[model samples]
Target: MKNLVVAAAVATALSMASMGAHAASPNELAQIREQLEALMQRVDKLEKENTELKTENENLKAADEKLQANDDYLKSEARGLRKEAAQQAVEVGKVKGADWAGKVAITGDMRYRYEMISDETLSSSGVQTADRYRDRIRARLNATVKATDDITVGIGFATAEGNDPRSSNQSLTSVFSRKSLDLDLAYFDWKFATWGNLIGGKMKQPFLKPGQSLFWDNDINPEGLAVNFQGGMFFGTAYNYWLTETSGPETNLTADTMLHGLQIGTRLPIGQNSLMLAAHYYDLSAGQGRAPFYNGSNGNTTDTVVLNGTSTAVLRYDYEVVNLSAEFNTMFGQTPFQVWADVAQNQDADDLDTAWSAGVLLGKASNYRTWELGAFYQVIEKDALFAQLIDSDFANGVSDSEGWVVRAGYAPVRNWLINATYFLNKRNIDAPTSAGQLDIDYDRLQVDFNVKF
Candidate 1:
């Protein structure tokens, strides 16, 4: 615009000069020069304004680019947040759909064992049998459900060769025949009071095994009703179980066999150690003179009786057993130590009715890299405990036996164990066993690999 104005002014001046030729005067020339100066000033002002506008436009463009970058970053962040939210929602839905899964618990264990049995038996023919070697396996699975706030239900299955209450081991034999899976546990426990519980069905023993006592075999699951109570340092258990049922009988004496048991104990703390003392009473009056045997008499004294038009051997005396047990636990530096003893007597038996066991354990085999060693000596006289209920591995599961049990265990990792148990025992210590009248040596070795989950 300045160039156009200047050109037009110059053209006009030239035109006047041409028209006025010699008539042109100095005044006209002065007027033209003044107009040229004004035009130059206007051009300088317009140039300054145009430079300022260009600077403002450049600043606006830079701001717009920065805003676009920030907007892209925000959009990317929103996408990530949406994905995370979706993942969380899926997890929440899964938990809501299986809410009852929290109330149920499943646990199981398996044991594989290599066993060697050596028995020294005396026979009239003077013949000796060879020692036996076998492999065995035991697997158990249990489920516990919290049915209600105060009620719990448990069910379990275990490998077994037969319905023998004293053992759950299935020997590996029979040309790969299928093994049996039997019901090992089925019970309901109700917390009827703050310090008491009512348990029924085929259930675990309610009595405490202070010394890991073998007076009652660990595998025995008694079908009965049990009540357990504990308050402060006092605890007690009572149970009644049926041994045999007799119905529609016509005889001189007829009744169902039953066993009743009660145990009471107390725990006393002494410094960092604790001591426990307990007394147990078991009565099987109804089983007297009854042929209520599962495996056999197992060296228990018996009387011959006629039943169902056949001759049979029945229990000779009632079993009214009284047991006293004590256990002391203490810590020696970082290792644990325990000492325990048990004495039992069947009051109804006239003679040979005493049983006793004493043991000491060093350390404990729990968690990884832990080990334990224990040894115990036991003497079970002929009429002491009910023979069918004793540990099957001890002295060939017979009464009138005296033995030593040495056990060692180690855990290489969590929930896995290696164990060895040796039994050096003599059967028929005082009286003849059902197998023979002569005393015999019974030795057994068991090595086990155990795993639990």
Candidate 2:
């Protein structure tokens, strides 16, 4: 019985121990599960924080890129501005350094001419010579200084050198002296709005009209003041001079001393033609003693007049010259045709002292060639004073004078010109010894080559 009771107690103790082990195992498992749940929540919160940090980094990167782009744009604009400024500075420098401004100009002309003459007269002694050829060169230089808008000073120098056919043995010298420097235009031209201009200084005489004529050549320039005005329809002038004298002669006679003249005229345009009318007056008085007779008179007592007199010789010379000129020119059409007529009356002289000319010109001027055919009829009445002064040459001593001219030219390029011309002159002079007049004629042919710059 004791053995059986011990066995039962052992069995009970073993069962209790097993029960306790089972309960502890279950509690440990629950605690483990709870710790695992907390760990999972912590990991989820960390993942959320990581995602927020990644978004913030992306935004910062985008902002940095934008700022870089803005910086690049600003730099580009700055570079362009700097380049433009530099270019402007260079242009300004060029303008400032340019010395050939508004105050400088240069002009000159050179002409080489060959002339052949028939019926040439000897000037030393009254005789007629054979036909001859001559060569001549003429040059002119002009310069100006513009001190102001209204004031200008200028100088002109001209020279001519030639071989005289009459004196071929003599050395070639200056036909006109080399030291001939003239005050071309030393004047102050006042600008006016209503009136044209008022010029004062050594200026051109107002009596003669400007034309390209070699016949009536007058190498005379005077010092005077002039007023020029031109409006819509009216154009006229009143010019008075204190003196009129020849350039080479020094004299105090009425012809060389205080002389006064006036010119009044206007232009009327009819279609493409123009008509000019002018009237002139000159009063001459011998201010000093009578002019000396250096040459002996040829037994002509009636021709001699004593100039030494106290009497106020009211020698009134009046002239009325009319110009009827017309031009028909075109750029591409049938060239040009021009006609002119000049008539003058020296009323103070005899009835035969009248001078008149009528001319007609037809030309075709183009880039390659220019040709003209012209004919003129000139009549100069007999004048005794003119005959005496020119030493009985046909040019001065004339009952009637007539001439005809023809010209042809070619210009292959700018600055160069080639031309040829022919002239025929005829004169009839009244011979005092004979009951009739003497007839004389002359012919000239000229070729010219000219360069201008």
Candidate 3:
């Protein structure tokens, strides 16, 4: 625009200075003035265009700066997120390292029972003893801690008294007094091999006990070391337990009464059915004569019936038992059914040394509102098995007895069971008590409600 104005001014000055050249024409001056007006208008339009270009350049510069700032902010935020994620990963690893509680588990069960026992016999004067009734309960709590991948330690407590290897029930007495809890089970099980296990302390029966416990009570927890093996269809077990704890009374050095037992079993398939057969042998000959047999409960039984005191012994018998058991299970009309037999013999007894039991269980009470029924007839002769270790409720725990037990169980819901068992038996089939000899009928009724978790 400046150059245009300069050129216009020089032209006007020359036109005026040379006006005499066109002195004959006045129209030239008017035309020159009109040309000057058009130059001024062009200069105004060029100034407006320059101002708009400057404004556009400023806007582009501001936009470029805003974009750069946004990029820097995004980079900073990504760095913060990476740091947070790394911190979270470290915390997760620490939590995994401190997982002691996760490696342990807890389990337990509770059972309440009501028992009615009756002894139908006449005294020497021909009068019967009063019927007995009691309310009993058994409770257990156990914990299993995994110290290593293949080694587990367990400890448990139960409502029990003394060292009654035969029972864990404490009768409700002393007017609902608080019950006592004893160290019922404690053991360490090491599975060092794929087919064998070593367990110590007072633990569960390592040997496979048949449905009918002829020689050992189902509730007995042996205090000893046991090793069990299983390979394919064959399985075996061997263990030794302290039968009597002696503080010393007998002079003989070989009077330690220990129980050494062995068991071996096999399972064979017959068509679609299977049969499990087992043979068991236990030597208790060391506990006879000199050694004392305690009532597992109070350490007393008929054989060791101390005449009003603990010194004199009336009966003593040597026992070495060999028992055989078999179980056959099959489907009976869409439900499982089982038949089992347990027979044990004391090889050292002269007479009444055989004990046998056979039973059948129909259906299964494994689900909600399910039911099952079972019945068994057992004959345990005198001196067959240790009288102290036998079932306490059968034939009043007296040997030389034969009886039948009928039982039924129902499950109203999962994990809950209700059962009823009735034992009809006759006691003292051979030897006569001091009150002469009477084949006394013994009856017991038990109703139990049990829950497990």
Candidate 1 per-residue lDDT, tens place, 352-379, comes to 9999999999989879999999999999
Pairs with steric clashes in candidate 1: none
Q: Which stretches of candidate 2 lie over 4 Å from their true place?
A: 1-100, 120-127, 160-188, 192-194, 204-220, 241-259, 264-269, 272-332, 364-368, 383-400, 431-437
TM-score (all chains, Cα) for each model: 0.79, 0.57, 0.75
Worst 10 residues of 2 by lDDT: 163-172
Each model's lDDT: 0.90, 0.51, 0.80
Better of 1 and 3 by TM-score: 1
- Give me the candidate number with maximum TM-score: 1
Q: What are the per-residue Cα lDDT tens digits for candidate 2 across 93-151?
A: 88855643556556777778787778643434555667877776666676666656665
The number of clashing residue pairs in model 2 is 0
Q: Which 10 residues in a row give candidate 1 its minimum summed lDDT?
A: 431-440
TM-score of the candidate numbered 1? 0.79
Measure candidate 1: CA RMSD.
11.1
Q: List the residue pairs that clash in candidate 2.
A: none
* Candidate 3 per-residue lDDT over residues 1-453, each given as its tens digit: 667685877686577758667563567666766767676777778877888888888898898899899899989999999999999999988887668777788888899999998997668786787899998989999999999998999999998855466788989888878888999889999998999999989899898765545556688788888899999999999998876665555565346678888999998888777899999998874666643445532112235444334655533556788999998888877877889999998887777888999998887876898999999999888878767677777887767888889999999998899999999998877765557755778899999999998
Please give the range of 10 consecutive residues that has the lowest summed lDDT in model 3.
296-305
Candidate 1 error regions (>4 Å): 1-93, 250-253, 433-436
